[model samples]
Target: MKYDLIATSAMGLESIVAKEVRELGYECEVENSRITFKGDELAIARSNMWLRTADRVKIKAGEFKAYTFDELFEKTKAIPWEQFLPENAEFPVSGKSQKSKLFSVSDCQAIVKKAIVERLRSHYKKTSWFEENGPLFKVEVSLVKDVATLTIDTSGSGLHKRGYRVDQGEAPLKETLAAALVMLTNWTPERPFSDPFCGSGTIAIEAALIGQNIAPGFNREFVSESWDWIPSSVWDQARAEAEDLAKYDQPLDIVGSDIDHRMVKISEENAFEAGLGDLVSFKQMRVQDFNPKKDYGVIVSNPPYGERLGDRKAVEQMYKEMGKVLVPFDTWSVYIMTSNENFEKLYGKPATKKRKLFNGFIRTDYYQYWGKRPPRDNR
Candidate 1:
């Protein structure tokens, strides 16, 4: 059976996620931070396992207008929840509200839960409480202007939890955002790639995965794997497709470096954990000292923006050093994501283009400096 699915992404990455969904052979509608599509069980399995920039793969169960509490309960109950949830399903409802009559999120959550329980209880003919010892069905109720949209989370953990981050620095970049940083650049598998602020090597590791066309979820599992409706054979075929498409033997020129030796060690461990230790290199090197000999290389970094106390002076100095050394490499493009508004002045060069992105709660700008095109044979 085909189900309506939505892939949630970061604010500025809706188009990117939509492009990926289209690449997966699905027509998608892109909204503020969500991409909606229709697919079957294999679509569910492949989306949960392949979408690199999405936060979560959710099933859009139902949507309708709800003004009163009674109306909310009736409308929610009207949805065919039993079509997805089994007799022994353990469903927990979460909620959020905005510009709606039901301003109380907890109240909305409770009402939805009760309505679902009532419907399920009647369908299953259970006189007692649900045992709650079964596969998990995470339900979410989001309200906007009295219109409620219900969905079930297929991804238990956020997609950024690719199951390979053995360790991370204090301010590590999210894996989904890291992959977006790479996808936004012109860096292909043949082009050299480096991350100067590779705190946990997330950027480099994601690049390696993309370089070899490996599925991001290849090393992880999703919550829907336990749902009986989606058979093991569906997952098996998805894995088999991933295995066949992966470029395990492909060569990647990727490196990650950090001034902190501890972070360097952590980066190495994380890369090894991601099963790309042999394909990528990590080292203890300052951003100012990184000297690239190859032309047409791509440099992506999530540098310090001096948000924390006592980091302003040092971060400014590093920015100056980067400006002095890197801006002259006309043949190599540079991309930096930072909250520092004075980055252009400190870097002594204006970016060719800039795009706004949010790193968690911090608003940052992605600075792009496109380099000269490589020779025909070199490309």
Candidate 2:
């Protein structure tokens, strides 16, 4: 039951996702936005249930080059569809084409769907139309520079949907991206963690999860759970492993604060929804009022970049205030995500390092200011 598994990530988080995959005991190949590895059913369950930064976990069915519709059909049909899909499986084909001869996405979808139906019909010896009333198997055919890759979606909703966040702010960050931001920081459970712009408390909650080593998808259900080919015992074993590994007794000093009282309440509600209310705290406060009580702490914030009209001046002033208060804490590492090009000028200092990351479609820079490392004995 070895399968080629691919974990898709955000535009710039391939390395982090690949690191996570390797940590999960799988050797992975890092591509632009996907990490491919050889795995089995247990790997599928473990990947969907644990990869905090991946968007989706898919099983790569096949890959080939296609120049025309006939070639597409034949190449697609050559795949052993019967090995994956059952007779009554509700498989839907989605397609996207880029710089390829098959420029028509809808046409490619239709042709692929027809070819899969032909293959299934021949395998099952069914003359009537497929009922498609059984388990779901979502399929995608992506064409990049005339090379086609076909995959089956194992994660129903994106992994960012951790089934939490009953409420959110107008510009809340994604759960996956928040986790990535926390992972990028030099933070540990023994140190204090804070997010000044705690929209929906995503970063703080993700930190709490990381601190406790809890599986991100432990409380969520995935689409592949309904597939009959994967035994329930496999999922149970994965869940059992997750439950056994979680350090629930580990205390975390994590906090999230926001200027808006409404957002503060929303953050608290979302944190509780994620089962992290006891481990993390949320409050209403402005970024200027933030003061860390612990040395060698970490601050990761996703402040408003003033992408909207007339908010640029306010955001700039906020950045200046962030520099005024947090920068002077030489023992605290600070990380900020913003799209402003003049962030260093506004923040009053150049960053130790900067990384280019995409927050959805907005191009942004992650400004990192390294702080003094704690003494070995103190650490």
Candidate 3:
């Protein structure tokens, strides 16, 4: 049962997702916001359980070029939908069109739905209307320059929902994005890691997960788990392997702090729910007061952007304070994500390297200041 799978990611994270796919022993092609790969049923289960930075896993059912409604219908109908969707399946078609002949997204969705229904009806042979009492198969039709790609969503909920963090602070970072921020750094399990502005402790928790080699999806479920096309034994095997591969006994040096006491409490609760109760520490403190005792540490933070006009002056002052406090630790690498255009100027030091990233539609820059690695004898 070889299938084409697509792991969708944030706009700037396609390469990271591709790296994850390749690490899973699958060949992948990296696109703008997705990675297309070849795999079997086990690959599907494994990917859903292990990819920490992907938004969702989908099955690429078919792809073709279609200019007119008739062409769209024919091309969509040509796909073997019966092979995936059972007679009682609840399939809902969604669509998007961009710079294509079929500019109307609703019309495209309706046409695709009709084509799939007709195909299923012909294959099943006794269908007036499908009961749809079974598992859900969400189908999506995307058109770009008149090329249509049909896919079925395998993850009902986005992978960012790791079943933890029932509560969060204002403007909480997505778990997927948090994992990506950790991956962007050069931090490892041996190095101390801290997040000064840890809103709900997403970055610190993600760092702990990385250090322990824990699968982000270990505590979650995916839509494809109930699909008839995939065997339950495959999922069982994948989960068992994930459990065996996890390094629960591995040591980690991670901490998170926030100015708000309530947020600190929320971070503790989330960390406990993530099964990292004793592995990571959380405290309530201002960023300027942060003083790590270790050298060659890594500090990654997503701080206030000062988007409101009234808060601009205060946030600028905070940034200046951060510069003053952080400059003394010349041996610690600092990574900060912020939407402030003048962050470098306010921080009083230019970043060694800067990368453009999006923090939930607010364009931000990741300022990286590489610290010199400690000598081998000290390490």
lDDT of 3 by residue, 274-304 (tens): 9998999999999988988899999999999
Q: What lDDT, from 0 to 1, does candidate 1 have?
A: 0.94
What are the lDDT figures for the candidates, one per model?
A: 0.94, 0.94, 0.94
In model 2, the Cα lDDT at residue 86 comes to: 95
Expressed as tens digits, the lDDT of each residue in 240-263 for candidate 1 is: 999999999889999999889999
**Backbone clashes in model 1:** 0
| Model 2 regions more than 4 Å off | 377-379
What is the TM-score of each predicted model, taking all chains together?
Answer: 0.98, 0.99, 0.98
lDDT at residue 100 of model 2 (Cα atoms): 96
Supply every candidate's count of residue pairs whose N, Cα or C atoms clash at under 3 angstroms: 0, 0, 0
